[model samples]
Target chain A: MQLTGAQMVCECLIREGVDLLFGLPGGAILPLYQTLPEYPKLRHVLVRHEQNAGHAADGYARASGKVGVAVATSGPGATNLVTPLATAMMDSTPIVAVTGQVPRAAIGRDAFQETDTTGITMPITKHNYLVMDTKDIPRVMKEAFHIARTGRPGPALVDLPRDVLTETAEFDYPEHVNLPSYKPTLEGHGQMIKRAAQLIRESERPLLLLGHGALISGAFDEAREIAERAQIPVITTLLGIGAFPGDHVLSLGMPGMHGQAHNNWAIDRADLIIGVGMRFDDRVTGRLSAFAPNARVIHVDIDPAEVGKNVRVTVPIVGDAKRVLHALAMQVDKVSRPDWIAEIDALRDEHPLYPGGSGGLRPQRVIQEICEATDGRAIVVTGVGQHQMWAAQRYVFKEPDLWITSGGLGTMGFEVPAAMGAAFAQPNRPVWSIAGDGGFQMTMSELATIVEHNTPVKFAILNNGNLGLVRQLQDLFYGGGRVASGYTGNPDFVKLAEAYGIWARRVTEESEVRAAIEEAAAVDGPALIDFRVEPEENVYPHVPAGESVFETIESPAGREALAWLT
Target chain B: MVDVTLNTERVHTITALVNDKPGVLARIAGMFSRRGFNISSLAVGVSETPGLSRMTFVVEGDEWVVEQVVKQLYKLIDVVRVTNLSAESAVMREMALVKVRSNADTRAEIMQLVDIFRAAIVDVGKDAVIVEITGNEEKVAAMIKLLQPFGVRETMRTGRLAMTRGAASGARRERAHTGGSAPDAEVVP
Candidate 1:
């Protein structure tokens, strides 16, 4: 059908199965917005800020495993999408951002609202195009979606000039994109897979390190089968928290900066490390040189750039994680190491996490109770810092691809939108966003989005009135010195939630923790439960940079207080 | 390690197909530099196909690194084909110009070398001889090295220019003609 470029853009989105878009209307994008009313199937979510639109799109993409779409206009609108674009790039989320640029004549003349959107986003985006011709719009949009969803999925931008949007075009969206320059490596080298399998079978102490790639590749079943068959202990990164059930016999929880002591110990002792979809980020590796020093690594990722970028891979298998895992599972002989499983079980029992407090409710205990109450079925999302680490360490995610958080970028305002996205994607499933006081405040403005949508998301705020993670770092590294970490004057989050027209509650006593969570979970709309805890509380089992993961410092006061009580 | 003298008469032109991505040219150049390969002359342009770029590299490396480099270029997502005209049965040519110290007394002697090399005097200065030479890499290098004895003043060389051996001539010419017709207009948006 012959259509204007603006109508064709929406038509291409509908063809690509985009159900929703997060954006705001502006002058440069007026033509595209003018055609939006014609496409009723495509939902447009108006965000308060362009940044929020990007984050919301990212959240939607990360949770739904679809190409999240966002739209904005020139100058500030395009620039505002940078942060979320960079965030999605770092985290490898599949997103396509479409922005409106000034007319072709206005380009490079410093005309009103004219900005080089494509140039500004060059480094952050995987690929981008400036659509000057109406004929290129359909092809570029198709390619943009393809590029965004394929390989190491990342955000791609298509800047449509205002004139092109208004111009008429023969709108035939290409069914197949034939970009010879952009073919991603999909199949693993057969010999490398065999070598990985042989290494796994030969090792006496082997550990499977799961990352977000496993979830992205939808390899949870294969990952689980491999662990069960090999009887290998599994350790996850922050992104890999819900890739496998933490309650499983071989599950060692998340291992990294704020990982559990037992998980770090297991990683340290492992003879072979089979890393799937997890780039050894600094937060997870602690010290690059010292990370998994004793273990030989077999790294599998779709992106060749990530193979030897950080930790050297003894055996590098470049392919889709799910495909490689399935191939490995099919070839490997089923053998159980009973002794290894027993040892891991013993470690879990001996180093059981202790959550003890008197007047104030402990965040760790609250998480544990929530996990028990929900039966490890709820999808838990978290903001960055102490609460995030606490959720990673304490929550027992029994299902794969259930726990969602901003692992790579560690964005503070991620949890709320992410939770909303998760709730939208998995409507029947319970989604809870466990955020800290500082992180909760960053995107708390999105509480309106939650309230308006009526997403059944439960919010548990661990309010300590400080940036707990940075404060802890300063305490440990800077000799107990306090700087900007402390937020002296803060709004009462419960009152703020009430003002936003959501059910709000505060629990100071330990007895009220379980009931508050239960009450929040029962709420039909969004609910916020703020817990006032100890101000000086710090996350335990933290491996400082340039230090081995095994070398950790437990929370001094909390540990001492627990020991005294015992 | 086999020191086989290259029979230069049979070899002429080469063509390469590579993925059209940023930084690929730099990588190929870096490889040539590391192997100490010398190019007689070179030219690069986009291929007839969209998303595929063609780079013409002319160099002389040990048979091993050259073969390895060809294989390695294939491993890059962008590089589709690498052809060595010097090894293949094809036509080879290069463009070069050398400026040598010249005077009224030695102008005739300098002209003799230019004629022998089939080079032309593109420019002439009062005290300098600027000769343009076009041939294979070896002939260009030999001409420059030979003129060094006569107080060579300055030298400039294009890397390499290449085309396929046979049967592929019509395909490339057609592409070149079509590419020329586009007027090379930049997208203004």
Candidate 2:
């Protein structure tokens, strides 16, 4: 059937099984907007900003395991999406960003609303396409979705010229993409797999280091089974939170800076480290030479380039995480090591990580209370900084894929929109965003997006009146110095949330933390609870850069609490 | 490891089928340089089919290293095929013309060497002999090095041209047989 380019785009989106699209229309995308009414199944979310559209798509993709779709007009609109696109790229989120460009005739003429969207996004996207002919729209759209969701999933872009949107083409969606240049390794090499299993089997103390790739590849169950069968303690990167039930006896929780002391200790002592779906970023590994120094590392990742990019891998398995884990599980004998589990349990109990403080109405305490009250059923997303780390460290998630945050990019203002996306994807489930004062304001413009969409997301802002993470780093690393990390002058988050038509509450005293959380959870629409935490509070168990994970500094707060306990 | 130094004189060429994407040529050239292979000359052009480019590189390296280079090049996603025409039944030719400092005394002697090598003098100046020689990459290199002793002034060489033996056609024929469309020049936005 013959259809206009705009109609063809909508049809292609529907054919690709995309039910939701986050975008804001402009002059260059008017044709697409005009044809949107024809597709009733494909819902368009009007975000307050194009950046929020990208974040929303990222959230949707992360939650639903589908390619998140976002659309924008040319020029500034497309440029605004760059931040989110880069964020998604860093985190390996599957996303398809469609931008409307000026007609092909005026491509390089600097026409109004014209921009080099493709060129701007080249570095951050998996692949990109510019549609000059209406006939190419279907194929390009198919390819964009394929490229975005396949291999090491990341964002792909398709820039449509205005004229192409108005042009006519016969609609025929290709069933499969046939790009010889694009091949993603899915199966592990048999020799590599056998070698990895042998290494794991021979080790006396083994550690399974999980990363976001495990969650993205849906290998959480396989990972848990492997750990349980092998009796190996599991440690996670910040992004790997909730990959295995944190409350499990063998689960060591997040490792590295701001990670659980027990988790770090286990990683330091392990004889063999099976790192899955993780790139061993500097933040997670600290000093490379000392990271798992005694351990023979077996690294499994989908991206071949990432195998030896950071740390040397004794055995490298390049393939999909889920498939590799399943293969490993099948080949290894199921045996229970009661001694190893008990040892890990002992460490967990001895170095128990309590919520920041019980006597104070602290953000960390509130996050812990929420985790307890909800039984880890609620999906917790966090903005960047101290609250992000605290929530990651304190919450004992019992389910895989429950915690969401900007890990690789550490993007601020990610939680609220991402929470909204998560809530929308799983409507019956409660989704809460924990944000720090500084990170909250970065992308707080999306509160309007949340309110407009009625996503029913609950938000908890750790109102410490500063960029807590940076300030804490400055204080500890720079001789108690203060920098621009302090945000002394800030708006009242309660008032800001109220202005956005969200229910708001403020908790000041130590006694009000639990009640404030309860009140926020009870609200019908999106709710924001502003917890006025101690301005000087810092996340502890911090391993300074170039230091071993075992060499951690206990925060002053931790020392004070311990002294009081004594 | 078996160490074999392969030094052969023939009309030989190497044909590489690479993804017609950006930066591919530079990657291929960098690979050659990194492997310590001295490239005599190189040429790259769009294949008869679209989305594939044909690159011809003439280089000298240890046989083992050259084999390893072929394997490593195959690892690059953009590289579709690599053909070493040194041993296969093929037509290998290189065009080179050298300008030597040919005064009345040495001109005849330089001409005699060119005749012995079946090389032709394309241009001549007051004090130079421009010899045109078409054969293999080694022949061109040997002629250049040999002429160097005669005070050769300037030299230029067309890398290599190769055709398979009998009716076995090249990449163009393969693409045609596969019934694929020609590669597109326009970049995907």
Candidate 3:
């Protein structure tokens, strides 16, 4: 059937089962907005800013296991999508961002609202296309979705020229994409799997290092099966927070920067490290030369480039994490690991994991109370820095994919918009946006988007009056100078939320944390709570950036990093 | 834990067949640089097929890293086939034009070495002679070393291009123009 490019976009989205799109209409994308009323089943959420639209789409993708769609106009609108595109790329989140570009005739004449959206986004996206004709819309859309959702998934951009949107085209989406070069390995090689199986069999102190690939590949069951059968302790990278049940006895929670001392010691002592779906990022490896000094690594990831890129791999398996883990699990025999478990337990007892506390509100305690009050079922999304680490440490992710954070990009201001997107995508499930004072202020404009949609998301601002993570670093490394890291004239977040007509409260005492969280959880619409946590509190045991995890500092001279446990 | 190469600085020649699509080269180059792989040299051209292009790039890495590079190249939608020319039993070759400062005294010596290396002196200027050589990495390096004593003026090389030795049969519909050698000749299954 002949259709305008805008209509073809709607049809293609419907074909891909996309129900929601987050964006703001502008001069260039007006045609798409004009055609929106024709498709009643497609829901469009108008975000306050383009960056938030990108982040919201990222959140939706992570929560729904579907390609999230974000739309923007040309020029600045497209430029603003950069951060979220980079964020999605870093975390391997599948997002499709559509930008309205200048007309083909005026593309090179510096026309109004014109930008080289494809050029600027090429380095950041998995792939990008500048659509010059309406006839290619169906094919480009199909390719965009296929590229964004397959292999090592990341964001893809389709910059639609305004003229193309108005032009008529025959819409024929291909039944199958003929991308012979883009085939992702879905099965592992028998020889490689057998070698890995043997490595696992011979390993006495085996550690399964989980990463986001496990969650993305839906290999949580296989990861658990192998771990439980082999009696190996499972450690997680930052993004691997929910890949394995946090409450399981074999779970070591998380390792690397700001990880518990015992987890570091355990890694240092392990004889075998089976990295599944996780890249050995610097944050997870600490000092690469000293990381896992005694362990032989068996790395598995869908992205072949990641294998042996950072840490050396003894047995490399490049395939879908779920498939590879299943194959390896079949070849491995059950074995008890009493000695290794005892050693890990002994390490834990020697330097127990703890939480930081302060005289006023403690971020960790607030998050713990919130999680307890909610029974740990809510999908927890967090902005970067201190509060993110606190949330990661304090909350229990009972199943895979319940936790979301900007792992590789470390994006601030991601919490509010992302949580809004997650809540919108999974309306029946409870969702919470947790942010630090510095990060919450970064995208607090999203409150308008939340209030406008009446998105039922609980917002927790760990108001420390400073960028606590950076301040901690400055104090430790910059001779105690608080320049750049300390905040001045920080807004009253509760008042700001109320101005957006959202329910708001402020709690300065630790005793009020649980009550405030429970009350906010009880609300049917958007709600916010500002907990005034003490400034300058730091996340510990910090590995002091570029140092070995074995050299962690539990506390600074004048302060305790985790006083709660003490 | 076993570091095979005592020094990790090793170069690899990678050849790939990609769809003759716009931005395909940029995508491959961008991914290599973004991932911190140093591209020592790169060359591209239309292949024997109508819609396919051939690309060869030289990069520095250890064995495992080179293996990873080949695998990652497959991940690109536009790239249909990739081979690490260094790993397989294949003929590896490079082309270079070495301009050496050839005075009356050294001209005879340079010509003698060029003849011994099976190279052709393409151009002879007043003070320099440009010798075009095609061979494996070792032979080319040896010739360059021998010519350097004569004050090598400038040099340029097409990094490396490789093809499997022997005639591999390809299943292609006989087209009059192709003489039935239409590009599936290089396709690896």
Candidate 4:
């Protein structure tokens, strides 16, 4: 049977086992929407904004371990997806963004909504296609999914001209795509794996710095086994949060500038460091010259570029994280370091300093309450800013893949819709989004999406009345003269939620934090709460950029917090 | 560990064999720009296979950074093979077109310099001459400099094309080195 390009697209998506799509409709994509009703199994969530659609699809992909799909029209609609696409690109998430372009004749002429989306997105995507022929639709869809899901996964975009979608053509989706050049290494070289295991065995004090790759390759069990066998302490990067259980005895929570003081100390003090699936981001490595000065690094990742980009590596193993971890674990020799464990415990116990006199609804207390209420089982998502870091530091992720946040791009309007997508991906699990006042307003439009889908996502607005992270930087770096970071006006979030017809409340004191989280989570449908956190509260253990981790400010009380490198 | 290492900007000629997928060139070039590497010269041509194209580009960076960039090029799905060839083991060449001020008096003098550099005079206007030269970067640079004394009016040069010197063929050969011996006229007039 012959099918229109729109039908062909639908068929290919169904063949790829794609059951959900997030998008907004427009003039060019009307044909695709018209053909959608024929397929009852494919559920489509209409998002208010294109960026939210991209974020929702990305969140869905991360939660479901499947390729997430989003769609939009040309011009502004396509451009709005750029931020989320870049976010997915930077963090290596799998998403396929489909956009309808102006008719073939109108392209590049700026007809109605014509834009060079393929050209604009080339830098950020793993790959992209601008399909002009109806016959090429099936093949293009297959290739887009293949590229987005393989190797170091990232976003891919497909632009379909309106003429192509309307034209009729025979459809035959290829069972398998054989791109001779597109080979992803699945196993580490035996010699390199052996060398890595050897380095781990010989070192008196070994540390495992887990990154996003660990979660991407589903190497959680292998990572745990290797750490337990070799008696190496495990430290995580921001995106690597849930790969290792926070409750594990050897697991040291998030190692960075704002990472746990003990974790940073472990990174600095180790004799050998085994890195799995992570790029040593500049944020994680305070100053490259001073980072892990004592350690010999073994970097394992699917992307060879990441092996030696930020820091030097002693042994470079290029392969999938799970396969390499399994091979390397088999070669590892068992060893116990009583002295190293003692030192790590001492550092953890004595180093961290929390600020005092927080009677108002503190963000840290709010995060802690949510984690306790959910038993760390809920899927926690957050927008970028201080609340993100607070949740990262406070939430004890007892299992892998429970915590999701925009780490690399630090997109502000990510959480609300991303949580909705997460809820859709996993109906059995509870999903909650924690957002700052500044970021919440950026995409509070997603609240309608949650309501329409009736996705039972609990929304927690961390209302600090300012862009907290930027304010922190300005305060410390600009002689405490805060500038444009503060918000001149704000909305009553409780009233905002009530307007959306959702169960809503407000928590002003620290005492009401737990009850508010419990009430919100207990609701059958989506709910929201305004937790007015203390303003001027800052994230501690702050490592100023280009400085050593040892120079971290533990609190805002002393000269260190007030001091500026300039 | 008696090795001496110096930190300096080193130029490397890297060649890639990529499928003739649409936007493959832009994809590879975009990676270079996004990674903040500088491309000194880039020349691409259809390769042995119908659907495959050979790309040769020159990038200058610190030794380690260049190596990392080459590894990154390998990660792109469209790229079939990539080789980073150095100055010693590869046969590299570049072609240049020089338009110099010439008349009955300087035309003969320009021809003498062209012969010494093993170049050819491709075109001659009433008061100008277009000389074409094919050689390594140094040879091409020399030809342009020598023609400069004749009041050089204009010059255009293909960056560099390179390949390895070997008996190995097919897959192993494609990944062996970065340059090709045959210089094309893409950048030259």
Return the top candidate by TM-score: 4
Point out where model 3 deviates above 4 Å. Answer: A557-566, B1-8, B87-159, B168-189
Arranged by TM-score, best first: 4, 3, 2, 1
How accurate locally is residue B84 in candidate 3, as Cα lDDT from 0 to 100? 65
lDDT of 3 by residue, B52-137 (tens): 98888788886655655665676566777776664465677889999999888888998899999999999998999999999977
lDDT digits (tens) for residues B1-189 of candidate 2? 011234553333567778887556656666566556577668777887888887776656644444445544553546776676645577777788788888899888888888989988887778876888988778888888888988867777777766678876564222100001212100011
Can you write out model 2's per-residue Cα lDDT over A1-566, one digit (the tens) per residue? Answer: 99999999999999889999999999988899989888999898888889888988998888888889999999999999998898998899999998999988999999998888877786677767788889999998988898888878899988999889998989998988877656677877677788778988788888999998898899988998898888888898888888898888777788887788887777767788898999888788877777776777888887755665566567877778999999999877676767766777777776666445444556667777888767888988887888998898888888887788898888899887788777777888788888888877877888887888778888888888888888877777676578788786899888888898889988888677778777877788899988888887778777777777556765565544433222
User: Would you estimate the TM-scores of all the predictions?
Assistant: 0.81, 0.82, 0.89, 0.95
Report the C-alpha lDDT of model 3 over A1-566, residue by residue, as the tens digit.
99999999999999988999999888888899899999998999999899999999999999999999999999999999999999999999999999998888988899998988888898888888998889999888998999999888999999998889999978898888766657676676677788789988989999999999999999999999999998989998889988899989998878888777788888889999999889888788887888888998888888766766677777777778999998888888999988889988998887765566547677878889988887878899999999998888778888777788998999999998899889988899889888888888888888888988899989988988888888877777676778887788898888788888989999989888888988998898999998888775788777767778656876553234423222
- Residue A16 displacement in candidate 3 (angstroms): 0.5
Top lDDT: which candidate number?
A: 4
TM-score of 1: 0.81
User: Which of candidates 3 and 4 is the stronger one according to TM-score?
Assistant: 4
Please report, as a residue range, the 10-residue window in candidate 1 chain A with the lowest summed lDDT.
A557-566
Pitting candidate 1 against candidate 2, the one with the higher DockQ is 2
> TM-score of the candidate numbered 4?
0.95
Docking class of 4: acceptable
lDDT of 1 by residue, B1-189 (tens): 011223432222345676676555755565456545555445777888887677776555544334334443443434555565544556656778788998898888888988998899988889997989999788999999878878888888776666667777513321110011221110000
Candidate 2's displacement at residue B124, Å, is: 6.3
| Stretches > 4 Å off in candidate 2 | A342-346, A349-360, A557-566, B1-17, B21-43, B47-50, B54-189
Candidate 2 vs. truth: CA RMSD?
7.8
| Highest DockQ against the true fold, candidate | 4
